[model samples]
Target: AIAGWTPVLDVCVITGEDGPHTALVISAGGVVSDAVAPPGTPHLRPETITLLSALLIGDWAVADASPDGARIEARGIVAAYAQFHLERSIRSLGHIDRTE
Candidate 1:
């Protein structure tokens, strides 16, 4: 039984070209947590954080106005993360032998 196993959503935002990135994790219980970058990782500016937060909350207005590079990087990161998470979850459920 996969007890207490709830889906989690992780979002990462990159400030700009070669800029620092920050990640946020939201659990199925609606709990939000911040994921810090490892040591030596560049720190993001307060404005960058705010912009990313807006993007995270579905603020299309802000997203539409954001720099192209930043927006594109954010989208790519999100897509990659979603794919990896989905694959991991499917694998954890075990494999089924279709051949009888």
Candidate 2:
């Protein structure tokens, strides 16, 4: 029932006081790595930023972003965990009408 555009909601993970928002994604090496792209884009620039966001949490701080991928303090599922939460959130938003 959480409606309205919540900026904080959009913020799936806030590592530090002011850090670039990020979500988790599978890397080319098949690792559940931090997002290469910033949040909310399609392909990589998806408007729906849940896939990555669902795995993040509040305490994790943005460690770095390199050719490898985004880095954070959190580990394993706790870090990669945001995906499930995001999936649910995206589902809650419901379906879009493509019948135009």
Candidate 3:
């Protein structure tokens, strides 16, 4: 089975050197196995991804503390998407835990 402190697993879509690429992994803690992404997966910029990650863990204010209008829009989109998925995952896990 996969190991380590991965309470959350997220993907950052980036414009890599080799055209549009999806992040296989990022940040601290653990390895990724059997990583795969189909073609044309939607992706956000790295800055947006960072903001989204921070927001996911309830640090939205810190991310948005000082940013321009463009930055604000990007962060908002990424943050919204990230929060939805993360919360859904947490609820699913909680349900599984309770049922067990």
List TM-scores for all candidates, in order.
0.39, 0.19, 0.35
Candidate models: Cα lDDT each:
0.41, 0.30, 0.40
**Candidate 1 lDDT, 1-100, residue by residue in tens:** 0343332222333222232334333222211223443344433333444455566566878766776556544444444345455554444223543232
Best by TM-score, which number?
A: 1
lDDT of 2 by residue, 28-100 (tens): 1112214444454322222223323433332223222211222222323222333444543344223644232
lDDT of 3 at 2: 28
- Arrange candidates by TM-score, descending: 1, 3, 2
Candidate 1 vs candidate 3, lDDT winner: 1
Supply the TM-score for candidate 2: 0.19
Model 3 global lDDT (CA atoms, 0 to 1): 0.40
Candidate 2 yields a Cα-based lDDT of 0.30
In model 3, state the lDDT of residue 47: 56
- Pairs with backbone N, CA or C atoms under 3 Å apart (clashes), candidate 3: none
lDDT of 1 at 32: 28
Error of 2 at 21 (Å): 2.4
Best by lDDT: 1
Off by over 4 Å in 3: 1-35, 65-100
